[model samples]
Target: MRLTRCSGRSCLSWLSTIALTLLAGSTLTAGIALDLQDPNSIKAAASTCAYNLLTFYTGNNTGDVPGNLPAPYYWWEAGAMFGILIDYYYYTNDSQYNDLVTQGMLWQVGPDDDYMTPNQTKTEGNDDQGFWGMAAMSAAEQKYPDPPSGKPQWLALAQAVFNDQASRWDNQYCNGGLRWQIFTFNTGYDYKNSISNGCFFNLGARLALYTGNDTYAQWAEKTFNWTQAVSLMDQNYHFYDGAHTTLNCSDINRVQWTYNAGVFLLGASVMYNYVKCSNVEESDTRTDSLLSQTNGSALWLERVEGILNASSIFFATNPPNVMYEVACEPPNTCDTDNYSFKAYLARWLVASIKYAPFIQTTVMPWVQASATAAALQCSGGTNGQMCGMKWTQGSTWDGTQGVGQQMGALSVIQANLIDQVSVPVTNKTGGTSQGNAGAGGGGGVSTSDPALSQNAITQGSRAGAGVLTCLVLISVIGCSWWMIA
Candidate 1:
């Protein structure tokens, strides 16, 4: 049966009212009903889910910041939320949120066009900045309408972020990796984590594929090697949290998160696709050497599958296919940030199918089961459509609701339409976003040089360092309890 598309706010509002009224006292729950086999059904469900998710966002209001969310949510999450919206538009072709997404993304490009806006500096980490960068990358790839002329173009924005992060690569501590925090005064400054490095690597591999730049590919290879060398990633491809540079990154934080694995999985898959699709001339030895150095297509395919297999840890054993945060969801200790991690995993997992199509048999089942489970959990809050964080609970709401919950639900449901949309576009594939090779500054690490010896730290007064230290200590203790429980 063909599902009618909910095209605008009025139509969606009327549908929501009818849904709430019909299910008010019925045995049926108030969550959106999803039909997995129907493409129109998936798109309609995603449109409704996206609408509910945007209801929490006041960033588009008259007095509020264009791209920012309210309290309890940080600036970085706003960036991530916009990225989700970009995916929503791409998957469903719903142009309703395009202007909002464009405004939010461009407003936070900071003074230098990197995502280091002064508003988030005190709390901004490398991973934080990288999320915004990834959003810009998505805009370019999805061909989300470009910003008006003279503004920072999507591709250049992504490149600027990559260049800035490449400059901050710290060889002084962990051999060569981005720290968890961008500024020295931040609490996690002494720590080197997977998400930060993963985001950098993810961006590099994508930029390489987008622009056909060997430099981006070279840096991507370096970052992937650094992660494994530091033992953050084991031989089987299980990614750990991170460790303090003070300990020389030897003592690993063994707790794993979905985003960590998801980020690297997409990067590896992109690298695999990039190499397999390269039609370089026989005479270009430098390009040939880069491809050979990455072990050509065989190694990347292995890494992608290895990471996917290891990701089974995030799913339930008895029920068998629903995804959750293995580190925190069991104990109900998922923080605001942890709640959003699964969305990326779900988003990236479906996305990897485009680059590595062989994984579809393995990936789509998980996505289908999880999306089904996720839709049923959206029976919370006054509206009766707000999503809860735990999908493993099935139809029973976990008694929680937030932007993260909604984002997670929207991502997986929309992901069911992955096969219906086009794969990401590149310059060679008719991408229209203008590219700037030297975006942020130095144009990232040199293609010829493998060493990342640049010092990008800025000295700041450690006036609030004590407070930040206490918070970090508390967070670490909380993480321990979650893992132990």
Candidate 2:
């Protein structure tokens, strides 16, 4: 999301999210949702946190700014959309992520949706999935169980994504880059998009692997090469679409935002890895170049950090902690949704603490959610809500339909825990453990997010719900498959 500079063209719209709700008659075989006539704050409410989170997460709706809805409202749901789910799958060995993602895939309708069907409501060129699609394919392959897919729902979503891109047939411009915008709102049409092209490059590489089609892989490589050659400048600093030199457009290529450049770093790093996997010789070449490329990416991250640090300085002018000039966008085509900015930037800063070759450690542990319901609830808010909600524009912590900010923060924490062995985990006996082990470690496979929470109140009652959810999900999956078969 950025400042409004488009030409009144919006690809994704409110109707898109609502459309999925309209057409998706399918239910989660995991059955995390209940028809229960009443709400249980402790059991049901806690479950609501994960259930809604999983749903948004699975949709692969996080992180990379959607041109349509640019608010922090969906930030957590989107970041955890990929970053959290992938790490947790390996850390906790739980089915929650699967349920979240697979069910989400089934709910596709727009650009990032697994189901990328033609919609008259959408712009002609706005059909790419960006990083979200790449992450979804990765999650499905890594975590999905065998047979009947543990939930046959994913198949439809996957097919939809593939069809969406193939139908675009946008194999022109900067060598197969996706034609991102016919015209971004107040902003003019951003032709030859760098972000979505990189995503397609990644997806194409995966398709080449999964379908064993070298053509797609080659396309991925070529696109990557074009993007790199064209997009990179000033020793690998990223641009919105590509370098200004390679562009025919006037101003569109001139303006490069913090995240726009950072995404290229993220994209290049991931794409190079996939390219290497396709061949041993390529692997070695990529491995040799990986550090340099990652360094470039780190540089972009550093730049982003600089801007955020300055903004936080400005916000600090307030006695308490007021969000001023936070450099967030509104949920319009041109500007990003501001709510998402806070959510995403927070996670990005945390990520820098873990990765990024250049280390700048700033671990703000105070932000962690409280262990108890009362403690977790914001102090000043009435009837159980976050105090921050009052200050935060557009959206609340109490509303249970699901909050993107929570999903974003939760995903970042989960990813942090899973990536590192240092995060403490507990066991059934209620003792301390480490590196995804002991009684709380879910029988040693190590892929669940909930098991790693260090605090007692958060981790205390989750195991039962997790184990039951898994078993019931497995059963439902079996039955769902049998019925389909």
Candidate 3:
């Protein structure tokens, strides 16, 4: 079958009309009606949902960058949208957005081939870079089409990101963990967050599974230990936000976000599955130790279960099985970043089901119920199908719309078809992307003087630095105005 190649505003307009045309007859007071059990019906719903989400993107327009979203949406989110699109293609086998996805993924690889694009350097956090890295990792895992011969390959790009982040494993703060922001000038540099460390762990476990490298697995283990040691992740597997180094990371931020839990959950699940699938020989003690360690697969399985059990907070008891962001959804205080957090949670939860099949019984009910609730909330906006942030509101529109809300809805709705597709493939299991063990070795931030702040400069140079900093802040604040307004 020939796939339709789509690009720019014309194609986006055409795709946006797809759901409206297909679902016009099935509309209810809630929104587009979806058949939860039918794969084809789910696919159609996903198509429309994805198209509506794409409407918020202006990056494909003439003057804008290919992989970026306009003001009010940060650069990290555009990376996430591409990851969702990658999953969209993997689940539905739709090539309609393949070109766009490829363009977006490759466009921001930055000068060093890591995700540290100069434009975003001022505000780029380790978590921000990790999100983009995970997108490239997803592309490699999904066996998405490779770039042209001269450009970076999918697996190599993921490896590059992993190697770069591994270099930033700071020892200066509370044992060892990555700082939230990459550059010290950024506000959150002194903070050590779960999402940043969790993303590194998540990427490491997947890379280990894909490449059969014990080094990646070892790093995953170390990261998990560090997170737990710092109390960012408690004994109950409840992942917290972060802790400031100024207090020696002793005072933990108890705020729980779905994405943080989701990140660690998927990483633990991947390690559990990896241990179960490993083929280490008993005679090779070193290899056996690497594969099992002290806790072995049992520890990871326990972690996987503990995380899922604790995640019950995100689901609404009133609705019985529907999912909601407990931290922000109830108070209606989710900022632009908070708005997109549930999408990653939903995305990882369904994915964890694939790695740990036993979770299917527990996960499917939430997936099915939440997908329907999310679809019902898509009844708002000018097009009559725009998704709202609060799915727990049921048919009530909640009077809001944006890329995050659309992404959250699209992610959950498309996730219903997860059972129909193949699980993520590894290099040993028919993955075709090329590998690079040393991709970003020389490009990451320096670890020699961890105490040295990038913001610390001479008074003579402060004028120039202040001017540049102001420009970046102005740009960021200008972009943020629309979202807060």
How high is each candidate's TM-score? 0.86, 0.46, 0.85
The lDDT, on a scale of 0 to 1, for candidate 1 is 0.80
The C-alpha stretches of model 1 lying farther than 4 A from their native spots are 1-28, 441-485
**Which scores better on lDDT, 2 or 3?**
3
Indicate the TM-score of model 1: 0.86
lDDT of 2 by residue, 354-463 (tens): 22212233223212221111112222223233222112221223332234433433332333332332211112112111111121111221122232122121222221
The candidate scoring highest on TM-score is 1
Name the candidate, 1 or 2, with the larger TM-score value.
Answer: 1
Off by over 4 Å in 2: 1-101, 109-114, 118-128, 145-176, 181-190, 205-217, 228-234, 241-247, 253-262, 272-338, 341-402, 420-485
Query: Per-residue lDDT of 1-485 in model 3, one digit per residue for the tens?
Result: 35478889867655444322233234346676787768887889889888988888887899889889988989999999999999999889989999988988888989878877889987888898889989988898887888888888888878888878878888877988888988888899999999999999999888877776665767788899899999999889899999998888998999999999899998988887766556554444553244646457678778888999998888886555778889888887889989899899999999887677777778877777778778878888988898888876667788888888888888888898887877677765567888666677444333443332221211221111111000111211221111100
What ranking of all candidate models by TM-score puts the best one first? 1, 3, 2
As a TM-score, model 3 comes out at: 0.85
Tell me how far the alpha carbon of residue 473 in candidate 3 is from the true structure, in angstroms, after superposition: 53
> Ranking under lDDT, best-scoring first?
1, 3, 2
